[model samples]
Target: MNAVLRTLVVLVSLVVAAPVLAAPAADVDLVKQRVAKVGVLRGEFSQEKQVAGFKNPLRSQGRFVLAQDHGVVWTTLKPFPSEVVVTRDRILSRQRDGSSRVELDGRQQPAMRSVNAIMFALMSGDAQALAAQFTVKVEAKANNGWSMQLSPRSAMLGKVFTGLKLQGDRYVREVEITEANQDVTRIHFSGMSETPAALSAEEGGKFE
Candidate 1:
């Protein structure tokens, strides 16, 4: 079978299996509550991107900081150095020299605004927000861990991303994004630290 056809089969199988998917909703609620109490989070991440026809998956490593009140700072340290800051109002990409390479105001771009909301929901573990945009299924695993599958509800988004799978104990540790045409992006997060204190000036400045 061709790659596109194979991907369609995989997606169809996932949808057909959805009826049997079941887990404790209360457990997910408790996990969301625990995540809500965390105001600041810092972690390191490694990401792998696979595209159809590519001989090898592209790999990148990075660190990130998420402040509920401020925004998110994502620094890519591998392959090349780059940074992206996403806030409620705008998204900015900064070069290694601390100059802005690109900036998109959410007020002007509806698509970008939606992207910002989804990123924040993913980073914050906002179950309510996530549920509003995707159909979710949760399953508990051994060792106090859990997994969730989220399928996009919007037709437009469905064309871009068919589904996402997230796994974690208390905080999100891994995310797998399955897109149309059989491409996939997987991110693994580790060394997470959650704090109640505010972000430092430098971290906060990224959003500005």
Candidate 2:
């Protein structure tokens, strides 16, 4: 081949091969770091719940917040104003009637236990962490997004839902959590990102 033609061919090969390589673990870690920096997440979601003995699946809508270093605050905005606060130490809940209840160990209530399991799944995308609780696998990948499939690792989780599809898109597009007994709960998050603002102790009192 001519000198100029050979030089051109080598340059094209390098350009084509560069993007085909997968990023290192550290590079992948950067994606999580940027997400964690926001410090908090506020979102709206719709839930469909079905249990072992329920005749019909229950449908509800609500808002939730995940505060940095504290815990998550889940507020039901439709069909009720019930709220669930899950902290590092315990899980507390309230209803529209202003009644308060606390359950430190999720094992106490079947529903709370199921809910907590789902919440933790949405917190991070660590492969090992999720694999421990669910049979997780990559479903698809693209330049802009990816999809992961997960099934509860435990029978208790299976009692709540059969499978889940955690889709990573513009701000975690959708969390499709389904009940093993034929109920489905798909929650979509939006208009939320990490913020530098902090939740005040007094302001947070409304939660407890």
Candidate 3:
């Protein structure tokens, strides 16, 4: 996928987790149901997005790995080699050729804290808890999982997603991130596998 589009997807789908996919797989329904059961996934995805204040959309592609308790990694391997690692405590980001940034809740960066909260909600896939946290509405849901539409319950979430759409299952298929300015970026996911795959802890954190 295009780098800009992938970036947009990461910014949107993973506003709270890794980026995810490469190819379509069989038993698509079975895969989604599995995600609902396992709750952790390893996959790759190609995405495209458009944000506010930008004339054109941004595109990108990346890999995603998630662990129910350990954490999640979203890595963009093109245009730039960058990664975000989210865990129980913090959301940390590093770029292969850039600075590594770390922010903890109620400690330093307020923006990072808010982003952490949102990502936590996303990773957990707890609709009731997330709904309580944000002004979220379930646009759709069933055995296949759900699509949660979220708005800022407080000024905090608003700053990150502005207007957020999370397409859920075990792995996400789409995420739409909008800015307060009404600029919209849509990330559609395909070619994802929800197979019960695991990554070593150290392997999970490494961007390369």
**RMSD in angstroms, candidate 3?**
9.1
Q: What lDDT tens digits, residue by residue, belong to model 1 across residues 42-125?
A: 999998989889989989898999887877888888877888777777777766676547666666754455556568877666
Global lDDT of each model? 0.70, 0.54, 0.55
Task: Please give the lDDT score at residue 91 for candidate 2.
Answer: 67
Q: Cα deviation in Å at residue 199, candidate 2? A: 1.8
Q: Name the best candidate (by TM-score).
A: 1
Between prediction 1 and prediction 2, which has the larger lDDT?
Answer: 1
Q: Find the 10 residues in a row with the least total lDDT in model 2.
A: 1-10
Tens-digit lDDT track of model 3 for 46-85: 6565655677766767787766656667777755677776
Q: 201, model 3: CA deviation in Å?
A: 5.2
At residue 169, candidate 1 shows an lDDT of 76
Which window of 10 residues has the lowest lDDT sum in candidate 1? 1-10
lDDT of 3 at 170: 58
Model 3 misplaced stretches (Cα beyond 4 Å): 1-35, 97-114, 141-145, 159-161, 168-170, 194-197, 201-208
Q: Show the lowest summed lDDT stretch of 10 residues, model 3.
A: 18-27
TM-score of each: 0.81, 0.65, 0.65
User: How far out, in Å, is residue 161 in model 2?
Assistant: 3.1
Give the candidate number with the greatest lDDT.
1
